[model samples]
Target: MKLLMAAGIALSLACISAAEAPSNYETYYGGVRVDSDPRLLNHYNRVLAYCDREASLPQRGSPYPYDTWHILALRSCLYRYSFVDRGVHSYPANWFWGHVFEQ
Candidate 1:
């Protein structure tokens, strides 16, 4: 029982350390779970913020129009999630079994 408890504790810690923020949800489709680097998340956030202002948006005829920043930010969030899943979480291929089995 002691050995079982110790193993459980160690595994739970590993899961906790690997878990990513709920907002970080980018890499779902490609079977690519990227554990996000917090540094990268900060960088993406700053980039999105700087481009959010009306004045910062590109002119109407420019490729970097108002919508550009919105789209980029959305993409960034997706990437953050994907990176987190891939790089941090050890959600094995058989995680569905846990859902079905674990109460």
Candidate 2:
């Protein structure tokens, strides 16, 4: 019983950590690359802050996890701030699903 309890605790901890882990969606999608331009960097920082807040909330009418919503929010925020023009316009649908399943 003790061993089983330990295993359960470990599994719970693992799941919690995985859920909270930051997504590499920005890196994969190539939006808002950091550079020497201070103004652009500031804008990037603001976008990140906005996405972080957006990701923290439980998304209504969506079944996906926090990180998945985070990816969507980040992309939207980047496009809203005009950062996407400097990077690739779009990503394949599989890429989004891959991240979703990774969690």
Candidate 3:
């Protein structure tokens, strides 16, 4: 009985961790679905990194309020690559716009 209980606990723990694993794309800015192409993925990652750096800075006396600056910056960067918005906003499902790499 003790062994069975231990196994059950371990299994539950494993499931919990798996469920909490991070997705390949960022969840904060709606949902972005990047293509499997290496170039697109690299570009997406670079945009994310750049946006992250931009977001970390203080936004004192900025025209955009709160997190607007970050969102605008992200949109601007992603737009350069011709990312399309799917118009879904469910979040964690089909939310806001989707970004894809078009060659």
Candidate 4:
């Protein structure tokens, strides 16, 4: 559930085109999301890293549970990019039949 949620969050921030958006998370994606489609790897890995970072930061013995706002903001940012940019709003669903057919 966490992985999927994270993937959804990250995909929201991904670029719709190779030329669009900054390549801020591409390197991270290069390491994860093993699949036949190179594009899926690019999308999933980026989201995975962002979530890992966000979730891990709060786990390093913080005095308080990490701020929900910060986490929500991350997901919101992803949502913004997804909606405004019409980018990959979700994970492999973008590559699935319904989503792919929409393209």
List the global CA lDDT of all models.
Answer: 0.43, 0.48, 0.45, 0.43
Off by over 4 Å in 3: 1-33, 58-66, 90-103
Worst 10 residues of 4 by lDDT: 18-27
Query: Considering lDDT, where higher is better, how would the candidates rank from best to worst?
Result: 2, 3, 1, 4
Please provide TM-scores, in order, for all candidate models, with all chains considered together.
0.25, 0.41, 0.36, 0.25
Instruction: Give the local distance difference test score of model 1.
Output: 0.43
lDDT of 3 by residue, 5-101 (tens): 9997765433321111123333334455554456656766776566556544565222342444444444444455445333333132342124432
| Residue-wise C-alpha lDDT for candidate 1, range 58-77, written one tens digit per residue | 44122443343444443444
Best of the candidates, lDDT: 2
Give the Cα error of residue 102 in candidate 1, in Å.
29
Q: Candidate 4: which stretches are off by over 4 Å? A: 1-38, 47-65, 83-103
- 5-103, model 4: which lDDT tens digit per residue? 999776654423321232322223333223445775566457545643554454432222244434444444444334122236323355566566887
Top TM-score model:
2
Which 10 successive residues of model 1 have the least lDDT summed? Answer: 53-62
Q: State in Å the error of residue 54, model 2.
A: 1.4
Model 1: how far residue 51 lies from native, Å: 2.0
Clashes (backbone N, CA, C under 3 Å), per candidate, total 17, 0, 3, 0
